[model samples]
Target: MPKTTPTPGVVITRSTLHKAQELAALSYGSVWTGPSGEESSGEAVARHLEATAALLATNGWDRIWTPPTPAQLAEADAAATTETMLRQLLDYIREEERSASGRLTAGDALNRVARTADGDPDTGRIAGDVLDLVVVALTGHPSARFGYWSERLNRTFADITALLTAGALFARTYGPAPERAA
Candidate 1:
């Protein structure tokens, strides 16, 4: 008979497994050892299973995992564009409507603008430009308004994209793996 290939899995050392298990258990609150190191909480085997992914990650098992492709990076850039625009627009609108009465009206308008922009980057850009007019009308201070826009723009969308992309990749890559046989 042909030798069967072992079922695919990360080969981690026993110590790494122990440490990862401990950290994972702590994070999930499954086996919470009290501050005194005396008391402990109930164990949920199901929740404990949720910890396996983190175990794999911490063990250097995923070093061979594929890096983000160019297409994915481009997608992140597009998403970042829309996200950054929406955040800046929201902040600027809030800044322009500082008074209580204006805030009430601004709240409604802000919701409408958000709905209108939805996920489209172009619509976000347009909404932001229109909101800029409102800000200019509300606050006639040219220097202050320019300063705010400058600061907002300085927060590069690429940074936001990179952070979000990394988080998403981690979540996707670190899902629970099959249990080790006893």
Candidate 2:
């Protein structure tokens, strides 16, 4: 038998995409330099993946891509290995940041997101601005560079999980379909 597709309204919305894109931008950065005077690309990639994963977590498949059955939701959780990996990377970032710079203020860390594209109605523009700041911070320093990168990744991950959870709950409370028969 041919497979049947779910209804159109059952998936994630454009606003969700905008939000993910914003979060992703905030997460990209340069790699940290170890004591040996070398940088690790793996760290950078980890941060990127973590940010992407967070986006996924927040705007889960059902909310951002399509409406999934219970089985599909379970599969999504299984596929989210990125979340675990990102968490590890974040720990590394935090350690480095603490060692290199003592401690960074919240305003210093999230300033990028707050200052970009004032008065612009486009959400994407704001997101892009936030991303640029992350990129600058990651590449700018030698000591705590990796830490900044890792923290952004962790933040992204948190954003994703929160969004996904919120989307799921929203659907349960307000989705169009009647509750499925047990």
Candidate 3:
């Protein structure tokens, strides 16, 4: 793509780009801390944990059994026999804006810029240049995947991503996994 220069003052920082990348890692490992400083495990995770513990306690660590429900059996079968849900999901997101992945407006290009660039700056001509380039590059693409976003949205996603990332990193670094927390 040809270079795009933003109208003088529109700046998109590298940190902005980094934030976008982090938001896109939503499915990484089922581990993150929430804002309340509790285990990231909420109802969904708790159910999984409870089910697993019941299964282990009922049977034993060495035992394995078929999933109890037809729905579960279907899910298991789909694991190998079906097209990954990602393709269907991406299509659904594009058509209906009804998926979690659609929550991201432009993380991919932002991540590309952040990863390809180095030594992110806090302030100066280079910072301005990088941000301006980000705006231009993002806007250059059509309203397809990873396209333009308002700076505020980009910054917000970046911050959320940063928090989730820090939560995950600190949890792993400073404490045991939730099962071991007991």
Candidate 4:
């Protein structure tokens, strides 16, 4: 008989399985920390199992298990797979908005002008030209006002993309750094 190949999108690979196990172990340790660690094992394991089941279901493996009722498996199947890219994009936008609002609040006249202008006075004529390009790209219009706002949004989006790219590069270069205290 020919060697059987794994069906596409059916079974989780060994590496994925190992990563899941590592995540589960980390989650278990975090949950079971503190003075009552002994008391939290059962609850932690239950949570871990639920998470594992949801992960499996999302990856289309819920049908492989025999004991769980169809209804239970169906509920797991409905669990959402993570959308990290969308989440990261939204987070970057929020951060940009916060930074913009902060600059505006500080009464920085130069920043205010730079933020709204068609072109930067200090940064050469490229700022205005870039804004014009963005406006045309965004609205398909030749109007100055549309171009101005479109430029603002485009600049903001570009800044955000750059920040996220830099952040990822830094994270990759440094590995996972210790989290800062709140």
Candidate 2 runs further than 4 Å off: 1-55, 61-121, 141-182
Tens digit per residue, CA lDDT, model 3, 1-182: 63344343334444534443343233243233332334432222232223323333343332112232221112333554346566565565555433222222222222322332221111111222222333333345322122233334323433323322332233233333446432
Q: Which structure among the candidates has the greatest lDDT?
A: 2
TM-score, per-candidate, Cα-based: 0.18, 0.17, 0.19, 0.19
In candidate 2, position 148 carries an lDDT of 41
Q: What is the lDDT of residue 62 in candidate 1?
A: 21
- Cα-based lDDT at residue 70, candidate 4: 20
Alpha carbon lDDT of residue 18, candidate 3?
46
TM-score of candidate 2 versus the correct structure, residues matched by position: 0.17
Write one digit per residue (lDDT tens) for candidate 4, span 12-124.
23343333334334433432223332222222222222332233334322111133222211222334555755565567666655543221111122123333322123211
Q: What is the lDDT of residue 145 in candidate 4?
A: 28
Tell me each candidate's RMSD, in Å, in order. 25.0, 24.0, 20.3, 27.5
For model 1, residues 26-117, the per-residue Cα lDDT tens digits are 44332222223332211211122123222322332221123332221112345467778677667656654442232112212223333332
lDDT of 1 at 58: 36
Give candidate 3's error at residue 34 in angstroms. 11
